[model samples]
Target: MLDLIASLLADKELDCRLDHPITEARAAFNRAIAEKKTGPIKRLLVEDAVLVTGTDSGVISGRDAQVEVWRADFAQAGRFVYVRTPRCVLPSEEEPIVTELGTWVGKPEKADGSEVRGDYTAKWREVEGKWKLEAEIFTTVKSRDALAL
Candidate 1:
């Protein structure tokens, strides 16, 4: 699952980039939704996912659309680093599950030191002897300026 995610990040797939490991994504998404904050930024820590992020003001106004805007902005950024944490194996013996945590960091094209951040968790399922992303959830941590936008 991690390998597939790495490929997507490398290719910069705007949609369905984190679809692998579906369980983790869905868990994170559900948690964020439960937080129900007024701002567009909301987050949750799944069983094995960690959140590390930074963002610009563009996210605040988009509300539910923040993720969409981030994807577009990510492509426009000049300097960016996407980092992934090592995959972890769950303790339960019922199924073979893998969990991974990762983040995407982006620097503005013109600014000297402005940037955006995205953190995510991906879970993979071994279905029919294949590992694929079953769930994912992610959030962008933005700066005051980005939130204001």
Candidate 2:
């Protein structure tokens, strides 16, 4: 019984150890987006990260392309707020990768006060002992008003 208890405790400890860095990376990414800090956001992403935006926006391949798109968007945004809550952080059974599925809401600083709520899935890769976003895809949840229109 003591050995079993010890084994359980060790498993729990391992889980926490693996999860801590991913949680930190997620927080840092969200903070960068909320503060519109381009440098931090770029740093959190892999050099070849891919970002797919909703609303008919085409796939943005490569980190530089993604950064440029965000730069333009942030420039016009008076105040931008982005929120993401991870529904699941699943670790790959075979690879050094994790996938996160989350709900996200973004309110751009627009005079009309438009908001976008959606679900996003992101793939994170452990690169040199750091978790970096490798790719992300977002889909918007249409509001009742949008459906009516």
Candidate 3:
């Protein structure tokens, strides 16, 4: 499962279908929740959730607070679990420098005629031989160019 998760993370660059990764991530997270293995860092969306954005004037202070932002986004959007993980690099390899941790930027046209571009990241740990997301976050990025329609 860890290997699958790793592949899914890299698939963003490979241009592979993201649905598989999202599905797997969702199932893995659900299982973790069911088994009560998500740890203190993770909680259901209803318990806490919010959305942080640059232009929206909303902000999530810290790590746990960011989780709430992610929860809200996931709830408002579809429920497929999508995560953009850290790219690991060997000493001889160069890594991509992302401004934020576990941040993924994607924009799919919304029916309302607004572009939603955001970055998301997930923290995962090996628990009981399976990788579970301990923390996850989403931050919205706003731009006049992006919003121009």
Candidate 4:
């Protein structure tokens, strides 16, 4: 299903070349976050969707539960917003599911907090002609100092 989003990248030409339906759906979810709208974001997930956060590997399981988390984040006065940019999207030949690998960034609304960058993987399923997020796993890359033993 084509996402209800206008475009993921600022350049429409680039999006046309790179974006698949899954990427568009993912982009729509990101757009909803920027727009601070939970309703649109809710429709993008399956009932049993799961999310594994970056850094701590915290899990947010289930669609309603995840939506609630997003609701809380949006409710915050100066919370950071996470934006995901899909680098690769591969559909499974045997199933109606696709895997999306991407990079994400969390930019603070206020200038005080530092920006967070990470990599993420998302599993998407085509449910009744609509693409929905099944699960997403995140990994925050440690700094060179932090990585050193």
Best by lDDT: 4
The all-Cα superposition gives candidate 2 an RMSD in Å to the true structure of 8.2
* lDDT per residue (tens digit) for residues 1-149 in model 4: 11322244323333233456887788799999998999888999999999998888999999999999999998998688888988767677789988787778887766454677778878999999999999999888632222233
TM-score of each candidate structure, all chains considered together: 0.34, 0.76, 0.33, 0.80
Error of 1 at 78 (Å): 5.7
State the displacement of the C-alpha of residue 84, model 3, in Å, after optimal TM-score superposition. Answer: 6.2
Models, CA RMSD each: 13.0, 8.2, 10.5, 8.5
lDDT of 2: 0.73
Cα error, candidate 4, residue 102 (Å): 0.5
Model 4 regions more than 4 Å off = 1-17, 111-113, 142-149
Predicted structure 3: lDDT? 0.40
lDDT of 1: 0.43
lDDT leaderboard ranking: 4, 2, 1, 3
- lDDT tens digits by residue: candidate 2, 79-141: 557777676566777888987767787775552456677787789999988889999888787
Error of 4 at 43 (Å): 0.4
Tens digits of per-residue lDDT for model 3 on 38-95? 3332532222333344335565555466555445555554222332443331111232
Q: How high is the lDDT of residue 72 in model 2?
A: 79
lDDT of 1 by residue, 1-149 (tens): 44566666557543333444543544444333333322222232222322222333221322234444444544553534333332333322466765555654444445555565566665555655545444445557543244345
